[model samples]
Target: MRSNRFAVMRGTALATGLLIALAGCGGDSDDKGGDSGGQTLKGVTIEVAAVWTGAEGAGFKKVLDAFSKKTGATTRLTPTGDNTATFLQTKIQGGAPPDVAMLPQQGVIAEFAKKGWIKELGPEVQAAAKQNFSKVWQDFGTADGKMYGLYFKAGNKSLVWYRTKAFQDAGVQPPADWAGFVKTVQTLSDAGSTPLAIAGGDGWTLTDWFENVYASQAGVEKYRQLSKHEIKWTDPSVKQALKTLAEIWSKPNYMAGGAAGANSLLMDKAVTDVFGSEPKAAMLSGADVVSANISETKSKVGTDALTFPFPKTGAKPPLVGAGDAAVMLKDNKGSQEFMKFLATPEAAAAWAKAGGYISPNKALDLSNYPDDVQRASAKAVIDAGDDFLFDMSDLYPAAFGGTKGAGEWKRLQDFLKNPSSVDATAAGLESDATKALKS
Candidate 1:
């Protein structure tokens, strides 16, 4: 299946401007009237805002069209701009918010909940979601004891995507633990191939590696606690996690270029560097990049790609995936109806068919997916229950997690350049995080 290794950990948030536009356009329609047709609701148009455009956006539009036909309610879709978080914030502050917004980041959801800008899904929506989705959706959407959102689809992050033929040629098996994973990297390097392809320019992608290391070393729950400030930055496990990442990057031919030069590579280019040109690279540790890059290159799907669960050091748990939450802005009839529709099995099935990633809902059968990799990914997301950890960036404060936090990326780069300065790097991160929390 196409690995969700990166997508699952990268919680996406809608841009603020797009969200505001949706809210402004749909607010007046919420109060119009009930069903004008026989048993079908009408005169109510729900403004739906999403961060997707192009093919994915078209898929969402298809779902909206289906919903409109089913309820006789007109649906207006506004494509959120590339800057998803900013657009949503502007929309919320402007008092023009979409009735239903799909927020990719949990941090944004939590902030909106705190400000009372978004409405909680009441009894009707809650009942439908519980009936339709797994407990993971409910758990992720709940904040401060209220259900504010629902998980529409999920992505698994702790996976390593590889070229199947390369592994066979090298006579190396996928690693199951930290030691073996390192050995595999060395084996690939010894065979004259880049051991790993990393996209450091997209800072968020690099954050995934940090999260994986933290999760592997400190455990998922502890990592969550650390993000929330329940645990200190100075915690031994956190330090060790950072140290482990540094050590791994230090290995000969571990990364495409040594860690210093790897920072220049972009996510898509990184994938091509490993899979397209260097056929013997063996693997790329990323989320769905294999499939995404291949598709982008117009290469046939599910041909040379394979994925293995990310290896850990101790007490390994099931792989964790990240997903976006479908949030409600106002608890009017229209909003409630829309949310209920999202909870239905039909919505999940439609999402699976769209082919970005698998929906988190276990009820959606993915037998129709043309690609075996995506189908397997769907199964993995369904099977990974409470063990799943949404994107680590989402778990942390927005200041540090968002694009504005270039300092975090700089710290990693600086450390890579001079390993002896690890102490300064840790201290700076802790200080910055403290400032972020306070602000």
Candidate 2:
């Protein structure tokens, strides 16, 4: 969803070395998870809610259809758009919450579980989750020592997608560190190419930018502490990260059509700018799903649109990530059965075959993904094991991080437009974070 994007607020072990050590960790699995134990739902209809729509919504529907075929139950997907947390709350208040809901933000999962609005999964679902997901993922879904959610979709938010020809034309390779990255940007701009395509219109994209930089500059421990709000947003680490971001953002010519132009471009448009017929910029940074957005353009994925990890900003770069977890909101025969099905590799593979998806399930075959680029990306997450950091904004309360024209989204957009306002931005973010997290 544009509003919240990817987040991992759980204080866990996340480091750059994890990604390096796990590069060759992907392998095929024989456990396809096809056994259903003779469970059947002939006349049941299950309702699922999530913020996925468009191609993402369609891909998930295919997965649901697979579930229906395996068990003979009808499945319906309710697209909640960008404001899923608020929408689910309203549904609950009206006594009309869906049978199962895919919570994208962990903060919402905690809030809902604390309010007793969500129910615990049955033993069958729990066992399957333990088998399919890593301990870090399982830990993320657990609150107060009880597992209430199962993460199905996973994201690697550290990639920077760019056009192959653009890099060749600019005579620059993807840089490995922040200093090299800034030099590369300047080279591209000096060669008369817009150096970056930032999706400023979608504020969550800016949050992604900040998260990657913050996690890289601040060590994983500090990143986790700040994510849990143990430290204020005005901490010196936050200022350092903002200044690091300003290296590129503060320069108007380093971006396509300048800051004003970037402020009007959405996620897809930002991708198109670099991969379109007449490319406008050299690179766009975000999650692996940016590959799907490129498919809508003139680029040919692995051949034309290539990706490199976000440049390192510290002693080691952090692997920032995001995902959606399936939680039971209204327990019943259908909901229980569906929740159990979601924990299987079959469920992940079903949507993965439709492309534009990555599964966190360790048992899922890497071949299930549609392309080499995506396969590599998914392997990075699977290999990282427990050493993963989620998107920081996604870990915050929705009022502070998820809302549009308010909270982190608006404040980040303001900072992106005027990178010189670091002091004011940090103060504003701290104020907003305090109110939202406390409320």
Q: Judging by lDDT against the true structure, name the best candidate.
A: 2
**Number of colliding residue pairs in each model:** 23, 2
- The Cα error of candidate 2 at residue 49, in Å, is 0.7
TM-score of each: 0.83, 0.92
Tens-digit lDDT track of model 1 for 318-370: 36556667788877888888888788777766655656556776667777455
Across 299-384, the per-residue lDDT of candidate 2 in tens digits comes to 88899999999998998876988889899999899989888888988889998887778888999999998899999999999999
lDDT of each: 0.66, 0.81
Task: Evaluate model 2: give its TM-score.
Answer: 0.92
lDDT of 1 at 184: 83
lDDT of 1: 0.66
